[model samples]
Target: MNTRTVDARGLEPPEPFERAMEAIADLAPGGEFILLLDRMPQPLLRMLDRDGYRHDARFREDGAVEIRIGRP
Candidate 1:
């Protein structure tokens, strides 16, 4: 499966969320969207959970968080 990545590290509130949402919306079945952020995106995680998507978060050595979201 191919993965699309969105870099949201320096972005302010709502922009990262919006971009992630847009990416999620455009994802095909079995596709994955990876979000690179400065910190954990709790609100977005909740939204993904509510929408029944599967997700995982990993912390990078560079102090950024990588959130991978995929269809259930």
Candidate 2:
């Protein structure tokens, strides 16, 4: 499976999350989206979950976050 990684180290957390959703909506019909962020908020994560996007998300102690969006 091909995955696209959006490095959100410099951008604002919300922007990266929005962009990741757009990317998933655009590309995930055929493949998947692998979102990588330095840090993000919990509410946004809950929003993603409530939106019914099939994902595996986690925040590391080092402040890195990984969110994988696959078929719903």
Q: TM-score per candidate, in order?
A: 0.92, 0.69
Those runs of model 1 whose alpha carbons end farther than 4 Å from true positions after fitting are: none
The lDDT of each candidate is 0.89, 0.72
Cα lDDT tens digits for candidate 1, 1-72: 557889999999889888898999898877888889999988888988898899999999999999989986
Residue 54's lDDT in candidate 2:
71
1-72: candidate 2 lDDT, tens digit per residue:
557777766686578767876886686454667777876546756876887767778886778888777656
Q: Name the candidate that leads on lDDT.
A: 1
lDDT of 2 at 18: 79
> What TM-score would you give candidate 2 relative to the actual structure?
0.69
Which regions in candidate 2 have their CA more than 4 angstroms from the true location?
59-63
